[model samples]
Target: MGKTVLVTGGNAGIGYFAAEQLAAAGATVVLGSRSDAKAAAALTSIRSRVPGARLSHVRLDLADLASLKTSVDALGVDSLDAVLCNAGVLVDGPERALTPDGHELMFATNHLGHFVLVCLLLPLLDASPAGRVVTTGSFVARSVKLDPADPQSANDYQSKRAYARSKLAQMLFGFELDRRLRAAGSTTISVVNHPGGALDSLTPSRPPVHVRGAGQRLRGLPAGLLLHGKDSGARPAVRAVLDPAVTGGQLIGPRVFGLRGKPRVEPVRGGAADPDLAAEIWAASVELTGMEPV
Candidate 1:
């Protein structure tokens, strides 16, 4: 597969590993990280693994929509086979923070930025033979309650809840996008996949190049050990973008209840997966971002 793929937040964690695997598999992998140094390091490591791999990098801060617009145009791609919206902020403070764009940080970075980026990249994706959009979500979505009135979690803010809600928004967008694309007779497939508890501690620590939270490291060692490592956690997302048999609107995750096992298609439930929720959120996202993947 000589397809070109973009991985947002491709400098570390699941994103780094996913970019590595995709580059090795012959896809022209573009790594988008906010830090230029981190992106360069990731590219170096990936090149060492896949000698002469086609790779590039761009600066993109998901918390800032202006950067998202400028960065995509400069990625040196006329088309893309797939895009992995894998970058996200997790475990912020309990207080509600705002991005440069003035929207809630977590929602803006994790969901809104990607929402606009995809809209801007529609032409490129549409030009691909089998275009795919894979969003990296999580199991925490099962426990989230997003208030449409305060979707930004401005009222009662908790780091975990905000993170979970952001992922839920991503899942809903993925499914809704598939529905819209099909209705418009487009071949682009939008798929959602989660890297269930793929911890940073379970992965090789790369110092400044990789961020490590002390508490997460302490807990992740035990939790990730009981489940899956970062490498294994990226499998479902990789499969979602690479597997020809994978269709849109289906979720892929660990075979063992999304904990630790081979990646496979898994069914989802709850209000987050509801069509009405998807429509409502989609409309809200459009109003907020002022863009849509037509």
Candidate 2:
């Protein structure tokens, strides 16, 4: 039997391309989307490209804590070989927004939601021979530091800062999970990857899911030299989940200056490698989400 992988936000953007690539590699890709219509469209798009791709969907709204358990039960799988925590929210508004759980929108969706989902799925992941959790972080995370005391950004809130910090929190959780799993002597491993400088204008058209106009292609030509399309961006995460050589706690991303190139194992630096901060963030996550992996 082929390996089964769950990819959150697999309905669009980098997540869509990642799911397609995994399907092409013969893994059973389960797409976690908030909408059934979008999930169906994504499934169709992948099937159109990869004939005989085994695909399914589970309704997942990461911001809504109440729905996570339902989403896990909906997976209907005996074991999950890997989980790609790829979904995230980038709040564009100047004002802060909150999820139904009363946590900041970006932090809840990008970090806390995946944190809880991973906790719920630990059993299934453990059932696999070599279970993997691939956390999708961001280049923006490098410049920001997370305040565990103010994880929701209540005291200080800015759109870009919150988004970056949330990603930083997710990366912190990934590394910490690796350490905990090692201490427990479990077969599961956690890896983190960032899609360096992915732009929609540079991305290829996927028809009904996403279509780039002629002008977009012409306009994005210059960026192609420095940056890359989302298809290329999805590679690092894909490699993290599939590559046997990738060990726990390793950071993966583009090879050239951390921006644009083929996926390669990158060094963990800055706040991402700080064990003290990771532990604090893990505690904050448990406090905020009321969930933790066994």
**Best candidate (score: TM-score):** 2
lDDT of 1 by residue, 85-203 (tens): 99998755767778877898889989998999899888899999889999988889989877766778878888889888998998888899999999999989999999887766666
**Whole-model lDDT for model 1 versus the true structure?**
0.85
Off by over 4 Å in 1: 205-225
- What is every candidate's alpha-carbon RMSD to the true fold? 2.5, 0.8
| lDDT of every model, 2 decimals | 0.85, 0.94
Runs off by more than 4 Å, candidate 2: none
Query: Please, what is the TM-score per model?
Result: 0.93, 0.99
Question: Total clashes, candidate 2?
Answer: 0
